[model samples]
Target: MIVSLIAAVSADGKIAQSAEQSSLDWTSREDTRFFISKTKEIGTVVMGRKTFGTIGKPLKDRRTIVMSSRTGIEGVEWTSEPPADLVARLEREGVTRMALCGGAAIYDAFLSVGLVDELFLTVEPVLFGDGVPLFRNGARINLKLLETTKLGDSSVLLHYLLLK
Candidate 1:
């Protein structure tokens, strides 16, 4: 599967102003529209529990998978499975593409496991000097730039492929 990590980050590399802050609160309308379109095109999205909590519900028309220890979510699938195992299972089930929509730890988990094939980051104009970062656990992956798109006058979408 083509696994990509998608996020809208601030100038200072922060994904949110707070743990509960939604990207919709800070990202541009263009970025939001791009995110929705890209994820829907991918057909599946995986995110950590806290990220899901911020959104407060399942995203329409996509398979929502929350990586949580607890299960039985009404509209989404909940799993505690490791990133690679989950990706492998999804590939076996014939999923061709997936998006890793994150709140830090989820990004770290997938990237650290070397399962992410690409990154789609929308860089917003603002900066949060102190806030939740894009990668909580830190990652050391090199990327080759694939594309750069102007989401708006102040927002840019950076697309990159992971270098193996």
Candidate 2:
């Protein structure tokens, strides 16, 4: 399976000011458009419970999977399985592509298990001073830059291949 992680962070590498705040409020419009377009293309998005809560609902034309200990979430698939198991199951089901739509812990879990193959990041121009870091407990892994593109006037999109 081709697993990709997509996120927009502040200049200081924060996803949001707090758990209550949405990154969409501060991220650039170009990043938003890019994210939406990519999600539409990929079709399956996996995110943590808190991240799913912030979004409020499942995205259109996509399968939403919530990686959480708790269950019974409506309109989405809820699983407590680790990232590797989840990826294996998806592969068995013939899902060739998936996206790690994150808050933080999800990113760490996937990266820790060496499931992330690609990373797409949008670096916005603003600074949050203190906020949620992109990868809270992720391991130090190397990456090779695949491409970089300017988004709008300030933000820049960076695509990298995770070095195994």
**Reference-based TM-score of each model:** 0.96, 0.96
lDDT of each residue in 14-104, candidate 1, tens digit only: 9998888877888999998999999999999999999898887899999999999997569999999999899889989999999999978
Instruction: For candidate 1, list the clashing residue pairs, or say none.
Output: none
| RMSD each, Å | 1.1, 1.1
Candidate 2 ranges with C-alpha deviation above 4 Å? none
Model 2 lDDT, residue 131, Cα = 92
The CA lDDT at 33 in model 2 is: 95
What is candidate 2's lDDT per residue for 94-132, written digit by digit as tens?
999999989788988898888999999999999889899
Candidate 2: Cα lDDT at 4: 94
Best model number under lDDT = 1
The 10 consecutive residues of candidate 1 with the worst lDDT sum are 132-141
lDDT of 2 at 62: 90
